[model samples]
Target: MNVGFRVHQDVLRPDRALLEGFAGAAVGNLSDAMHGLYTMDSGIRPVVTPAARVTGPAVTVAVSPGDGLMLREAIGLARPGDVLVVNAFGATDRAVLGGTVLLAARDRGVAGLVVDGAVRDLDEIASLSLPVAARAVTPRSGTSTAGWGEVNVPVACGGVVVQPGDVVAADGDGIVVVPADQAAAVLAAHREVEAAKGRPSDLASGGEARRSRADVVFHRTRAAMAERGATVVPAAYHRWPVPPGPTAASRPDRA
Candidate 1:
């Protein structure tokens, strides 16, 4: 199998600070900030829970599924703070990245990794503290012998077309790609949107509005029973005496 390996040496990169700003930016807001332009699929999820957010300029790789040679090479070629965005043909049956590859990226100061394929060695990767987002996880390891791959080229990952130097921003919500040239503009737009939305209300302040599952069910059941001609006494009013044969203004609390 003559797997042709292609490397584009003159790949363009965005400014480091721009990438950092996107990294620190909200992933949800970034997706909105893109205006439906280039959001990755939601299928790609963090392998480990409580995953850290990753943001950096993309070093795109187009590779055959179940192969890791190109990925390993990409890691070495990627500069510090670069995120390797890999198109693995959406093959999740075999692992494309694992402990060794992750450690290599971490040691090189690579920002993170996003793969449209499966990965393994979760325990090792979890301990390494490197941010990773992928389609799935499998125990099967991939072969590095596959020689066909292209580095620093436009590729598709998680159903999104990614070009070299595109900003890859990922967090709990998933991944969003911002074109290299549009990074600054998108960042600015996201900040504007955030400001316009205003600060979210604190959960503590809304505790009175929160209802448990059982409470909700009970209220719904009471309504249904009332429709059946059954007299319904709401829990709150049950403890008190009927006041003046229930004035029209004294309706029971429905919530």
Candidate 2:
């Protein structure tokens, strides 16, 4: 299938400035930002470097049985800076991406793809050096390639709202959604986090305790536990360790 498109970098205007770069700030950490990050259930490991930048707004597709074929047309509709995001409705084992569809995106220079389902053609897609994010990898191909989709629609990739023109950033850590309004703010927050992180990791680990403050909470906790026949100890007093065994109340014969 032949696809055609070109994007002027000036028109897209992706932020390429060098900032207080943190190692993993560009993409939101899943642990802290679970609502925004979509986890791919992939075993084939689509590891991409940060240099794989995104430029366009998102072109969201909610895929059904015959929707896989719309990818070719999606690429045709997408300009250089667009990301093709697919909602597969949890059909992760069957491949939603293939060699043919990938060629269409690569040829048109679409930035990348994010799918909430499975994708195949690993070796071939990798050879083309396409940036793709998906749930898993499988040998299974979509049953049909017929067009069944809506253009410029909103789709959910694990609760993250992907709309047309939203910036989708993803790397090994995970994918993060930045609504057009917050894209610049997220970037600013990223720079601040990186700046703070520059302080030695050891410094954060060092002197993390106030012996007096901990003693109060520990003693209070221990006293409460002891009332219920349980033993507790604070790390500050290593010698007074809590005993590990069934207490008198735990043994019926003793009662």
Candidate 3:
């Protein structure tokens, strides 16, 4: 067995309609539906504002630090609306993809690219308008001859274990991964959340309902804290155990 250098040609992707259900869904909502899990770290951000939220099955790629040989291969294998999620060992000093390569992925109908390492060619990338996200940007390029990586395999990108065919969604806010098997349930939960919030048009007139929901959560949290023996006594800062510093009025003016 080649171990780290092998590729698995087949990935179990979610149904097309299931993937389409995630289109235009907010990453925040998806994260919330997952109970605040499956969100990529904040450091991974879109290199450019994507034309829309990129949502599709993940084509996972694992690469040796500072190399992109497998990334290119993944691009070639990707079908339309497949997101290439690259795990580059979080290397930031060398970019694995640049403008030219990103253009190639765009031309190949790749839905988007997310790298845990670095990428360059910001200007050209923006011009191409493909949805690309990475942890950093650098001009230094990596050598492709290292040739140690895998494709269509599970990888850790942005502190999350991304399996091939897991649904990946990214927008300006950030990226979130939905386990392939849980897509339908998460979508149902997301719909429930939206329903509870009422329609976007009703939000302006629903301030009271929003406040009521917040109060319920706040009081529940306070009750839990009380059961945990936590207590708070409101007091002015100057009245605390430590002696208060001189007040502004008591300090001598420089003038």
Error of 1 at 109 (Å): 0.9
Per-residue lDDT tens digits of candidate 3, residues 1-255?
Answer: 898998888789999999889987878788888988999999999877644579999999999888878888888888988999999988999999898889889999998999999999999988887888999999898867467999998899999999999999998889999999999999999888766655445455667876776676689789999999996769655743887888888888832
Find the candidate with the highest TM-score and give its number.
3
lDDT against true structure, model 1: 0.81
Task: Tell me the tens digit of each residue's lDDT in model 1 across 130-177.
Answer: 888889999998866465888887898988899998888888988999
**lDDT per residue (tens digit) for residues 1-255 in model 2:** 122121212223234342112223545332233444433333323434433544345777776632576566567777765678777765776887788898888888787888777888888877878888776777888888764554456677755667666666656655666665555665566556444333234334535444444565678788988889985445555466678999898898998
Question: Candidate 2's C-alpha lDDT?
Answer: 0.61
TM-score of each: 0.75, 0.62, 0.80
Best by lDDT: 3
Q: What Cα-based lDDT does every candidate model obtain?
A: 0.81, 0.61, 0.88
Q: Report the alpha-carbon TM-score of model 2 versus the true structure.
A: 0.62
Instruction: State the RMSD for candidate 2.
Output: 9.1
Clashing pairs in 1: 3-147, 3-148
